[model samples]
Target: MKARLPFIFIIITMMLNSIGIGLILPVMPSLITELTGGSISSAALWGGVLATTYAVMQFFMGPTLGNLSDRYGRRPILLISLVAMGLDYILLSLAGTIWWLFAGRVIAGITGATFSTASAYIADISAPEKRAANFGLIGAAFGVGFIIGPAIGGFLGEIGPRVPFMAAAVVALGNATLGYFVLPETLPQSKRRTFDWTRANPLGALMSIRKIPNLTGLVVVFLIFTISHQVYPSVWSYYTIERFDFTPKMIGASLGAFGFFMAIIQGGVIRMIIPKLGEMRTAMWGMGLNFVVFILVAFLGEVWMLFALMPLMTLGAIAGPALQGIMSKLVDDDAQGELQGIFASVTGIALILSPITMTSIFKYFTDSDAPYYLPGAPFLASSLLEISAMALLFVIAKRIWGTAATPAQ
Candidate 1:
């Protein structure tokens, strides 16, 4: 038990990282309405505001926390983040009104550093060759957590909306306790770098990453792929309902299936494939597979077809870990936290932008007064973005991740 404690702690942290948002999603509406004494639609608008506030704060803080871990070390930052997270969940549980909820979300967002820091922790302990596969474990943990989160939230939501928040509090604080006891500081004093406040925001982090010779283009590729990948979360429910008349239960089942398949591909499949094909080939294959799947989803004719494509749909999970590993190898040991921060910031931007863009496209196409109707238009746009990322990656592969840059194993 002692021998595996670090890995165990990390797995729990990773799962809590993803579970935090999802566990509350199913109950937020009821909670919001209870506090606001408003209509369901008004509660929904407030919910969106809370969600955006959380994302925006996370965007600003990603680099700050990453650089802090770089300077101070991962252990303190992670433990503090976890405790703060647990406290915020408690705040949410005891929230009496809408403003209380807003305050809780704000606190939650500012301290949400677990994912970035945990990535750095993994990078610290992992070898160059093994980094990608280990990164896949992060994905796998997140997938399974996300699948469990909403289920628990929905179930507890029936008893009371506040119940899920308390549940989240327990999970978070318990994880913090485990981490405190077993988690070692992965970043040693000799390896620690000075934390500059200059490169501690989104644009600054991008500039900092830009200084790394081979990573800038890959960052661009990563950004586009992330934005494109947002299609599912942005419009999947709306599209499925508008086109196929899917009910809430059907949507949940489909999404649950997606999460399960993603866990399998990232946890087991990538470990097997990356060893044989190498990170470069593994990434190319996954992104290429994504392009095909996106196009198929865009033009899909039948409800059954989407379900049939589910297994193939998740194969795209491989690209993210592969790309992450490739970039991890290119970066110096000291900068892993910053690199992970860049990835986090990029994700934050994508989260902010993609929903607006994709949903707008979906709205335009599905609107009664539109020029033409195509419910799957957002997926089509995503396919175009995916192909563009593929093209850019192909162009820059040799320059960035080639034999010279990657070095011989």
Candidate 2:
């Protein structure tokens, strides 16, 4: 337990942050509708406003935060971000108007780079041999958080939405205190690089990517894979609502199910499989499985079928550590901060693009009063993108890393 302290802290912090986010999402439409004189579209647009604010802030700050962590070390960045996250939750809890909620979201987004610092912390403490396992733990944190967060949110939401928000704020502040006191700094002073504001910009992260050999193709592959993966978040709620008439609780659970599968696979299975199948093959297998599972999801509209399909989503979880391991291998020790920043920024860019493109396609096909709303279209399109991404990933593995590419042993 002592040796695992840092990992535990990072995981707990992530869990708190996620729970804060989950608490607000399910009940917000009603809160806003009542506040705004019963306009459904206003509620929807307000929701979008909060998300857009978060995405935009994350888009700009991800690389800068990563680079800052590289220079200043992970502990300070993590602590500061946690404090900000606590405030974000508190603001949301007190928010009386839609704009207040939007303000809270924007603050949360600016502070949300906690994940990047956490990633740097993992990179700092992990041995080459243990990096994948450690990173898998990070993914597990996400899964467990999402799983419990919404369940708690839904239960508390029954009492009142503000209750959940206040609870989340309290939890976030508690976690922040714990992290400040208990979490050790992973990056030692000698290895800490100087922060360069000009170079820490997102463009700086991208430009630095060009300096590395064969990284451009790998980054492109990662972006493609991210785009393919966005279907789960971008449209899952809408689909579930339209298809099964799921309530807020059910929708939360559905989202939680995806995270649940991710936690199981990356948390348990990835560590075991990586040593045997090796990272590259494991990644390829995961991608292939995601393609199949998503397509299956499109066709299988039944509620039970979704429950069954949950395990299949785990395939994508393996790809995360596998690809991160590859990226770690691609860069030298000194460049870890910049490289991780690049990785996060590229992911941010993917998050920006994927939702817009996939949602547009979904709207294009399903604008009708049909019984089913053709809810599976986005998943099918996602599958096609996944297939293309998998092919590119395999090609990269073959050429640069080669088949059977194990993390440095």
- Deviation (Å) of 96 in candidate 1: 8.5
State every prediction's TM-score relative to the real structure.
0.71, 0.77
Between which residue pairs do clashes occur in model 1?
none
lDDT of 1 by residue, 1-409 (tens): 7766787788778888777666776667567768988644344346556766777778778768888999999999999999999999999899998999999988998887556678888888888898888887887788888877766665666678788889899999998898898999989899999999875757655668867877888888888888888777666656776678654445546666667777777668888988777777777777888888988998888989998998887888687877788788889999997797688778888877776677677767766676888877888898888889888877887665454223222
The residue ranges of model 1 lying beyond 4 angstroms of the native Cα positions read: 2-7, 25-52, 66-80, 90-104, 117-140, 154-163, 174-196, 199-205, 208-215, 237-251, 272-285, 299-303, 322-345, 366-374, 394-409
lDDT per model, in order? Answer: 0.77, 0.74
